[model samples]
Target: MRNIYFVRHSIQDLSVQDDASAPLTKAGNVLAKELTRLFINKSITAIYSSPYARAFQTVLPTAEKLDLIIDTHADLRERQAIWRLDWQEHLANLWQDFELKADGEESFADVERRIVPAFQQIYDDTEGDIIITGHGTALSVLFHHLTHGQFTFSDWQNMNMPDVYIGHFSDENVLVGLEKIAR
Candidate 1:
């Protein structure tokens, strides 16, 4: 059995000018530091993060503590198509016509394509524990897919920033257990 820990990036300050480039705020940094302590005893094989700054920032503390470099993956990024638009517009359209817009950014489906493969690659490459730092919506989608579409955003939103979900994968690469971390 392989254990996969899916972690949401720390809180981002949207008040900053660049939303995508927004690094972790003071609160986020503090939270990440605390989360790092939890991993001190665990053997985190690798750390994977989204290309976005916020996601990377969230995992930096843990990576630094473990003396490991974070591996960036484009598929681990947030829903890109919604990212380019205004927050309100993005939120409204996200529930409806995500793929209809003709933009270069990625939709939920596009995110799945990248994330699923990345997940498989990670599972294949390592046998112990793997940690991934990603955005909320993208992580939610991946969680849904991992659990055979039984998990939903509402179920995952309960996980706060830097929260971890422990998943068990079988020999066939099927996710068998998804236990939410309560912190």
Candidate 2:
């Protein structure tokens, strides 16, 4: 079966202000080093990740172990918009209305426009198991699309910092099975 493992990046340095610049925390780094284990004996044709520092750092170990370069995509980066400091509430609102936004805000629909096509390109160009390392919100949106609404904000809320979901797909691009990979 063709599989795509959508990986949510490990814990981020919350102290860092810029979403794109935050590297992993010390504990996050430790967890990242162990990510290679998930792909052992799996034929990963390619590794793709958001160019964000945290996401890139999270998957570096796996890419190195597999001898595959990480293909970075800006479209895979987390939602780039100014949100309230009370992010939990704001995110919950986003889930309720993917189109909800204020001035200088990027709605989930905007995010989907970029991420969906980028994912399609990745799916079309790659064969065998594929790994996509990204942020919580970004991966959640894509997975929700793949699972036909099964993966929701609740699932995203419960996601581990370093979370993995294995999705089995058919040749026609239909999802046949899905499971969260837990350690």
Q: Pick the candidate with the highest lDDT.
A: 2
Give TM-scores for every candidate, taking all chains together and pairing residue i with residue i: 0.85, 0.95
Cα RMSD of predicted structure 1 = 2.7
Candidate 1 residue 151 C-alpha distance from true site, Å: 1.0
lDDT of 1 by residue, 76-174 (tens): 888765345475456445535535444666666677788888878877877678788898878887887787778764575476886778888887887
Q: RMSD, each candidate, Å? A: 2.7, 1.2
Query: What is the C-alpha local distance difference test score of each model?
Result: 0.79, 0.88
lDDT of 2 at 51: 96
